[model samples]
Target: MPTSSRSSEGGTRRAAAAALLTPGLLALGVSFVVPLVWLARMSLNRTVGPAELQPDVSLSSYVDVLTDGFMWEVAWHTLWLGVLVTVLAVAVSYPIALFLARTRSRLRGLLMALAIAPLLTSSVVRTFGWLILLSDDGIVNSALSTLGIIGEPLTLTNNVTGVVIALVEIMMPYAILAMIAGFGRVSKDLEDAAGSLGAGRLRCFVRITFPLSLPGVLTGALMVFVLTVSAFITPRLMGGGRVFVIATEIYDQATTTLDWPRASALAVLLLLLFGVFLVLYQRLFRMVEGR
Candidate 1:
């Protein structure tokens, strides 16, 4: 082919790729970039009163958010929620994901659906359901009492414990799906070969299968952590307003107090936290791939 023709073809392909990407880029800008920029600008403004803001630009909002002990507590609560829920969800989903990944039964599809069935319901509905279940006199406490597992009803609601439990359930399906994808690359043949070499089931799983599935585990953990950090519904309902998180704080600042600048500052902090985690995730991914 002539050099000019080759160059022309390359340019055409580049143009086609750029055209295809334009809509997605535009959507992303409208949905994410523009709002982020707006928030950053808003964060720099001064809050004059509820539902009122001043046009003056300053770092007072960010300074207040950073210096406020309450803000730190909320941030701690948010991080704690994210870590607990992510750990619990990933732990609970691991075996289920492994079973689904290895199973050859006719009901595999049904089983997979069942595993993820909770996702079909709205989070609000599910959170309400949790409210019923975790209430002091609710089914969980009643069952525990009846079974003699406890002498009295546990204080499960309006606390971090209840929120963690509910968030774990809400986040499990995501963790399971990520793990299932991770397990796809973990070959059963490797396990069988290890067994043939006189490795016990647990040994084979620990030495061979687990390492291969770490990518999924890491992916699921990262995803659940991020979701949990930003989650509002389950925490609000299950925590019964006793648990204050960054999300709830932001909501209250934005809506109740109408302190848009403060709310925007908190949001920017949350975004920074997410960026830090993403950087850590990339590093971890590199390490995993290196191994």
Candidate 2:
């Protein structure tokens, strides 16, 4: 083909791509950008009374949220929960993901379905189910007592422990899926070659498999962390009013206390927190990719 024809074709493809992307971009702007802008503006406004917002621009809301010790505690708790959930999810999902990635068993499809079946149910329903299972007199405690593993029923619900347990279960599927995708880049041939060179299974995995899988692990961790931080339902139900993370804090301010400005400020801070982590994730991802 002539250069002119090739250039024209390239330009046409570019135009078509842009045309296809326009709708999505516009939708994102309208749904996400507009609300974010409004929220930022709302955060600057003053709150006069219950459900009453003043039109004046001020940083008092942000200042107040920053100075509030309880808010700081909530923020710390949210971050801590994010970290804990991400760690546990990754730990629990890694072996499952590896098995799914490498196994050629006949039951692989069934096993994968079982692993992800929880996702098909409503989170509210799953959370309620957890409530039943983790309660003091629930099946878990009864079974543990039957096995003589414990002499007493454990306090699992209405606390951080219950929230952690539920969040780990909720986030594991996401981590597993991410890791499976990452493990796609790791070839069995590489492991075989390492073995041929006298590398033991454990050593080969530690040096080769795990390193290659970091991308997937990191991706899953980031996803779980973000989701865990913003999670409201599981935490709210599991915490039983004992746990107060950012999401719950925001809900209480916006609906219960009717303080829109404070809620908006908390929201803005959450966004900023997300931004910082995203930046760090990008840098670490680049380093892992050797870019």
Candidate 3:
């Protein structure tokens, strides 16, 4: 073909690709970019009253959120909660994922179904179930007391511990599914070769299996971290107003105080903080993988 004809074909293909992507780009702008711009504008406004916001632009809200010691405490709490939930979810899911990956039992399908059954239920229902289980007179306390673990029912509900437990349960299935996919990609031949070379099961797993599965583990951890940090429902229900995280604070500011500007400011801060953490994490992971 002539160079002119090839160039024309390339231009046509580019035009067609751009045309096909236009609708998706427009939808993304409408759904995400527009709201983000509006949110940034709102965050700059001044709140004059409980239900009133002035059009005048200011940084008072940002200053208040950033400088306030209480806001810092809440941010710290949210951060640690996210970290704890991610750790627990990853720890709990890894073994289950390994089992699913290696099992040839006839009940594999049933086990997989059981593992993911929680996700099929509404989050509200799951949290409520945890509420009952962790309540003073609930099964956990009853069993612990029966085992002489404590004289009285320990305070499980309406606290950080309860929140952690519930969040772990919520994130476990996602971590497991991600790891299962990751484990599936790993070749069994490498593990067998290690065993044939006199490596113990644990040694083989530590040296061969675990490193190969790091991508899945990292993905699950990041997902759980993001979800836990941004979670409103689990914290609200499990914490029972005593435990205050950034999401709950934002909710209170927006709804109860009707301070949209302050809420928007808090949201903006949260997004920036999360973005920074994510970038740092990805860099660290890349560094580790490079080694």
lDDT scores in order: 0.91, 0.92, 0.90
Each model's TM-score, in the order given?
0.95, 0.95, 0.90
- 249, model 2: CA deviation in Å? 0.2
lDDT of 3 by residue, 1-291 (tens): 799999999999999999999999999999999999999999999998878999968999999898999999999999999999999999999989888878889999999999988899988899999999999999999999999989989898999999999999999988888778756545789999999999998999889888877877887788788889999999999999898999999999999999999999999999998898789769866764556
Q: Please report the TM-score between candidate 2 and the true structure.
A: 0.95
The 10-residue segment of model 2 with minimum total lDDT is: 282-291
Tens digit of per-residue lDDT, candidate 2, span 159-264:
9999999999998888888788777667899999999999999999998888888888888889889999999999999999999999999999999999999999
> Could you arrange the candidates by TM-score from highest to lowest?
1, 2, 3
Estimate the lDDT of model 2: 0.92
Evaluated against the true structure, the overall lDDT of model 1 is 0.91
Q: Which stretches of candidate 1 lie over 4 Å from their true place?
A: none
C-alpha lDDT (0 to 100) for residue 82 of candidate 1: 90
- Distance from true location, Cα of 271 in model 1, Å: 0.6
Better of 2 and 3 by lDDT: 2
- For candidate 3, give the lDDT: 0.90
**Model 3 lDDT-worst window of ten:** 282-291
